[model samples]
Target: MKLFRPATLVTLFTLAVSPARAWDYEGHRAVNQLALAALPTNFPAFVKTAEARERIAFLAGEPDRWRNITDDQALPHVNGPDHYLDLEQLEEFGLTPETVPALRYDFVAKLALARAQHPEKFTAIDPAKNKDHTRELVGFAPWAITEYCGKLRSEFSYLKAFQHYGGTADEIANAQQNILYTMGVMGHYVGDGSQPLHATKHHHGWVGENPHGYATNSSFHGWIDGGFFKKIGGVKVDAIVGKIRPAKIVGDPLKPEDLFRQMMAYFGDTEKLVAPLYQLEKEHKLTPENEHADEGKAFLETQLARGGQMLGDLWFSAWEQATEDRYLVTELKKRPAASAETK
Candidate 1:
């Protein structure tokens, strides 16, 4: 009988003990699993292993776990906004997703300037509830996804150099681990984007005007997130797995800006569904007993598929376009031969 490698054993052990939950945990895991299913055969072989696959799936909830740290106000302040992007709020700031600055800080500066120029358009936040100081700004989901893609690309670049040069097995394993962690955490944001509620101001029910008389229950967001799925006995991943096409490169693999634009476009596509989602709920279609519950289920399954497809494309693009990390290559070449052989 063959034995599992030490690294593989460690991974399995860690996953067994880690408590994970996001997108109601199961939804997030399904998104990561779906993305894995979408990967082509030529994508990295190590990531195809069962342990690595489970690690990625488990990580889909990592971002939400950070939300659990109540003692650290700074953590939630910085991380909370990344899970969403209120497209409607962008207009109030005199910006469109197309025109929003790609750099996070630049966008922050722009929002500050916008508020200074037009205070009347903004509502003052109540300091009592604004402990995180994030209430004034719209979310940053697109930028978060794009940044993760770049990080994954960098990981691939270094891993390639390490493998091609003289890096030891442990070094290669570590680099692959980095890639898996980044991919899994990033999946959280990508999965967040797939939910139409995360892309709009109507997030926690219809925020303002009641023209459509959509759901006003604050619990509505939680319901759509995973409650409905739980009521329906969870997502049917295998049923929709076949619907996901093979992963392909998105935008220009060499251009970060192109990827940014594509992320914005993806959000725009999801935003278009915001009204329809509310309408479905208003009609009780999302309820398990509703005659059209399947319609709601189909809508959600398609969104999950969308997240999986986009994530797979980003992963494929990162791998396909990762260039040699020349600096790392030069550094690796300087290491002693024995060091490379030890692991």
Candidate 2:
């Protein structure tokens, strides 16, 4: 397989050393590793190899690495919104998770039309700060997750065709590599969804209302993302490993729309916990030495486990549902005669 080149590895390592925006690199790595643990023994043997495991774990930080490119406006414009979904902002557009479109561009179209019709409901964007032009969007975490799952299924289908038909070793290896890359990168978004802050407009802190008097500290997001864990000693990955259930198919794996609906439900569930997260912070339970520190730790650990379980389920479902690429198989069946005629 085409593993990452030496220079590319160096660059990724450098980027990973920087602070993470969602679950830190360590947390992301844990999610991928846990997912690997969740996979059934009958799944692809190549993926369970030691080298592949390390590759997937390292790649869990890949999407966040894309954010380091400040000079590339296009990169952020496309990649930024995939990491979150501000659920609270949806009501402003008269949309709910159930009502939102499954396709990315379709959702964008609907959001644009809504903004045009109700300009007052949205905040005015300053040209100076809105260079990426993504300020108008809420987020697309569910769509991103669903699309990646579909991509993984496609990879599995083609790999199956390559194996059953006449195909070179290099071709099979490359297909396997593609699957690994997609699985690893997709884990980043899954990890993002597990974080309650990523699901709400109060991601940084309570935004508009003050009925509960939650802390509006901008640092709250960063703290929950990584700092709190750092203070409590890194994510107890081993502690939660046993909690992961075996991977299972999510929705109808053959139907992308079904998977999309499942993702929305997942995000909707996460959004419900946003206020409780704020409540924990307000009670000083998140502090390292507080008497209630263990409670906060358990909450965060559960989120991590949830991400890992969901990721594993998606991967397993993709493998189970992958059908042979019939067109590729038909073409491959002709290859031997074509080569003989040339000879």
lDDT of 1 at 143: 93
Q: Give the TM-score of each candidate.
A: 0.90, 0.93
Q: Where does candidate 2 stray beyond 4 Å?
A: 1-20, 254-256
- The digit string of per-residue lDDT tens for model 1 on 140-171 reads 88999999998999999999999999778998
Best prediction by TM-score: 2
RMSD of 2: 6.8
C-alpha RMSD by candidate, in order: 9.6, 6.8
Best by lDDT: 2
- Candidate 2 lDDT by residue in tens digits, 229-264: 988779878899998999988979556589999999
Clashing pairs in 1: 22-25
Regions of candidate 1 where Cα sits further than 4 Å from its true position: 1-22, 336-343
